[model samples]
Target: MHVTAILSHADEGGFTAFNPETGTATQGETLDEALANLREAVELYLEEFPMATRAAPFVTSFDVAVHA
Candidate 1:
């Protein structure tokens, strides 16, 4: 099954990956590593709690004004 992965830089180092579908998160040294880790985590989570329906999550972004 296909899932969404959100990746960001960690405060300390490396990258942090999160799967919105399964609510799974993990960290890795690189983008590839982060994605791989997220995949494994999502797989394990699914094995325990399978999703009843598979729907692709709608992802989008918006700009927010920052006031000084």
Candidate 2:
């Protein structure tokens, strides 16, 4: 099954990955490791509760104005 992965750089170090489908999140020192961890987490989640069809998440950006 195809799933969306959102990866971001952690504040302290390394990378963080999150799967929207199952709301599974994980972190690793490298991009590859982060993705791998996310994949493993999603797999484990799916094994317990499988999904028939996961709707693709719409990703967009919004901005908020700040006043000084």
Tens-place lDDT per residue, model 1, 1-68, is 77899999999999999998888999999999999999999999999999877777789889999999
Q: Write the per-residue lDDT of candidate 2 for residues 1-68, one digit (tens) a residue.
A: 77899999999899999998788999999999999999999999999999997566678779999999
TM-score of each candidate structure, all chains considered together: 0.91, 0.81
Query: What C-alpha lDDT, on a 0 to 100 scale, does residue 27 get in candidate 1?
Result: 96
lDDT of predicted model 2? 0.92
Residue 1, candidate 2: alpha-carbon lDDT: 72
Point to the candidate with the largest TM-score.
1
Residue 67, candidate 2: alpha-carbon lDDT: 100
Error of 2 at 10 (Å): 0.6
